[model samples]
Target: MKNIKMTIEYDGGRYLGWQRLGDSDKTIQGKTENILTKMTGSEIEIVGSGRTDAGTHAKGQVANFKTSIDMDLPTMQEYLIRYLPQDIIVKELEEVPERFHARYHAVGKKYSYYVWNNVVPSAFERNYSFHYSEQLDLEKMNKACEKLIGRHDFIGFSALKKSKKSTVRTIDEISIQREDNLLHFTFIGEGFLYKMVRILMGTLLEIGSGITALEVIDTIFESGIRSEAGMTVPAQGLFLDEVYYN
Candidate 1:
């Protein structure tokens, strides 16, 4: 069997996230796997780099699958594009070494959250960004970002109730930029827990709105309590920007 790697981009607005569900075919994984299975005439299961929450989007999601089908890479990609739903597209496909496992080999990931800060919302960006009409102090948000950089236990910022695996993760960078009325927040990290990025963004937003103190980030870290952290922002604003592998 040859291992085929694929880079996928999806709007994710109408899907039920990336994983295949037993009862539902409205998932990215299930849809893609079904198409592959149909084309290959055999069972095909693709392993994704990670799972994005429902309603979240992805620009560079990666996955891989092993298949014995004789079709070339380009043909397989073309077949996928022609048959898969218009919202999900396989941008690139290539044969890779058999040892490559998408999830296990992933080194890092980048997630971005969009916020519309203006009082008037844009019809085009309504589904892609979080609209917050209150005035936000960008400088205060930047200051809060400083405390979030580097390695720390991020359990307080995730929706995971409990895990035996370590919650500690390294955040290489966190940047917030404003373009007109849109605030773009980017996070480059080794890994993140469930809903971690959304919660982090919510915390920073609260600080920017003067609803929470700057030092609360440290307090949340020390306490590792979910309730102490800010709200988990809506999933529509989050995007899995890229998955890194080497």
Candidate 2:
């Protein structure tokens, strides 16, 4: 068997999410698996680097699957692109080592949340970004972001329920930047809990608008309680920028 690694990009505006559910709903993984099954005539499961919640886009999501066919990498990619839905694109394909697992072997992941802070939201970006009419203080946002960098218990930034064994994770970097009417928050971490990045973005926005004190961010981190943080931002504004493996 040959392990095929693929870099995928998708506009998540119409899918249920990345993973397949028994609800028979459309999903990114379900669509890919359907195409692969038609090509290989066998049931195949493609392991994804991570799960992106519904309405979250991806620029460089990774996945891997084993196939017994003799097709070359280029040929497989061509077939996948020809058959898969238009919103999803296969960016690259390569044969990887047999033992490689996309989620398990991932070392780091980067995510970006976008906000449009204009008086009127752009029609094109309405689905891709969160529109906030309030003026934001960039300096205050940056100050609050400093507390998010480094390892800590991120319970306040995560969802209420998680099956993961631990809530402690390392955040390698956190950056807040604004260009024109767009505000971008980028997060790089070893791993993340469900809705962690979204909740962090919400807290930072609260600080920028003077709804919360800058030092309150540090307090939330230390409190280790989900209710200590602001509301979880909408998933539509979040994007999986990249996944790192080594």
Candidate 3:
């Protein structure tokens, strides 16, 4: 058997999520599996590096699967491109070591959230970015983000009472910047809890709007309570930028 690795990009506007759901419903994994089953004539399971939430986009999501086919990498990639839907594309494919696992071997992940800070929304960006009509204080948002940059419990930024063994995670970096009317927030972390990025964005937005005090961010970090954080922003604004692996 050969282990195949693929770099995929998709617009997550219509699908439920990346993972395969029941009955092979609308999903990035389900669509890829359907095409793979047709090409390989076997029930193949592909493991993604991460499962992005519904309506969340991706630019460099990675996945790997084991297959017995003897096809060349270029041919397999070309074939997949011809069959897969337009929203999802296999950018590259390679054969890797047998022990390579996309999710398990992942070292870090990067996510970016985009916001259109304009009076009116752009039609072209409706599906890709979040629209906010209020004026944002960029300096205040940056100050708030500094509180999240290092290792912390992060319980306040995540959905509480989840079935996870631990809510403790390390955020390597948190950056907030604005160019023109686009507000970009990029996060790099060892891993993340459910809706963590979105919730963090909401809290920062509150700070930008002058509704939440900048010092409150530090207080929330100390509290480790979910209620101390801001609301979870919409998933449409979030994009899984890339997944790092060794």
Model 3 residue pairs with clashes = none
- Whole-model lDDT, model 3: 0.89
Per-residue alpha-carbon lDDT of candidate 2 for residues 71-154, written as tens digits (9 for 90 to 100): 888888899999999899999998999999999999999999999998898898788899988888888788777778888888
lDDT of each: 0.94, 0.88, 0.89
Stretches > 4 Å off in candidate 2: 162-164
- Record all residue pairs in model 2 with backbone atoms less than 3 Å apart, i.e. clashing: none
lDDT of 1 at 99: 97
Look at candidate 2 and tell me the lDDT of residue 136: 88
Sequence-dependent TM-score of model 2 = 0.97
In model 1, residue pairs whose N, Cα or C atoms come closer than 3 Å (at least 3 residues apart or on different chains), thus clashing, are none
Expressed as tens digits, the lDDT of each residue in 1-246 for candidate 3 is 999999999999999999899975799999998898888989999999989988999999999998998889988998999999999999989899999999999999999999999999989877888898789888888887788888878778888676557777888899977888888899999999888899999998888998888887778878878887888888888999899987
Q: What are the RMSDs of all candidates, in order?
A: 0.7, 1.2, 1.3
Worst 10 residues of 1 by lDDT: 227-236
Report residue 105 deviation for candidate 3 (angstroms).
Answer: 0.6
